[model samples]
Each structure stands twice: as C-alpha cells, then as structure tokens.
Target: MNGRKNVVEVLIFKKEVEADPRFNVIGEVSLEDTDMLDHIGEGIDVKLIPI
Candidate 1:
C-alpha cells in the first residue's frame, strides 16, 4: 500500500481588529468544526468573516 500523510497546517497571527478584522471575528464565524475546516483547504481563501 502506498503511504500518504493526511496533513493540515495552521498559522496564527495576532493583530489589532483594525489591522485585521478577521482576527476579531473568529468566534462569531461558526460553532462547528466542519464550517471551519471547509474554509481551510487547498485553493480556499482562508478568512473569518465578521458576522
């Protein structure tokens, strides 16, 4: 069997809400992991939309 790694990467950035609004609104995006995971894939624009 060919072995492959199912890996995911994450990067955390700290910034003022004015510098990056997305950082301030992560908590309001969604409560489900699927909702977050859906946005974190290849070619997907990773961002947290303020509700």
Candidate 2:
C-alpha cells in the first residue's frame, strides 16, 4: 500500500438514515468514481473532507 497512489477518503450518507458513513479507499480516483458516485446517486450524498 505504501507504493500505491491515488488514495482518498470519502463520506457516504445513506438514504433512510440521518447520518453518513465514512469509508477509506486506496486506489485511483477513476476506479472508485462509479461506485462512489452511485452511492451518492442512490440517495447517499458524498462529502470529501481534507485531512
């Protein structure tokens, strides 16, 4: 994982719930874009927080 690149943390807000869930994913942004976007598309909002 040390030699890997394009790691990002994302917060997903699930529908039917009042809060969001945080997830850590290590990989290229493009690789996770669809799933992450779909999570948001399916009523889960995404918020990228700086660390």
Top TM-score model: 1
What are the Cα lDDT values of the candidates? 0.46, 0.45
C-alpha RMSD (angstroms) for model 1: 10.8
Global lDDT of model 2: 0.45
Q: Assess every candidate by TM-score.
A: 0.23, 0.22
Per-residue lDDT of candidate 2, residues 1-51 (tens digit) = 688777444444332344335534332344445566554554444455543
Off by over 4 Å in 1: 14-51
Best by lDDT: 1
Candidate 1 residues 20-50, lDDT tens each? Answer: 5544433533345544554455556565445
Clash count per candidate: 0, 0
C-alpha RMSD values across all candidates: 10.8, 10.8
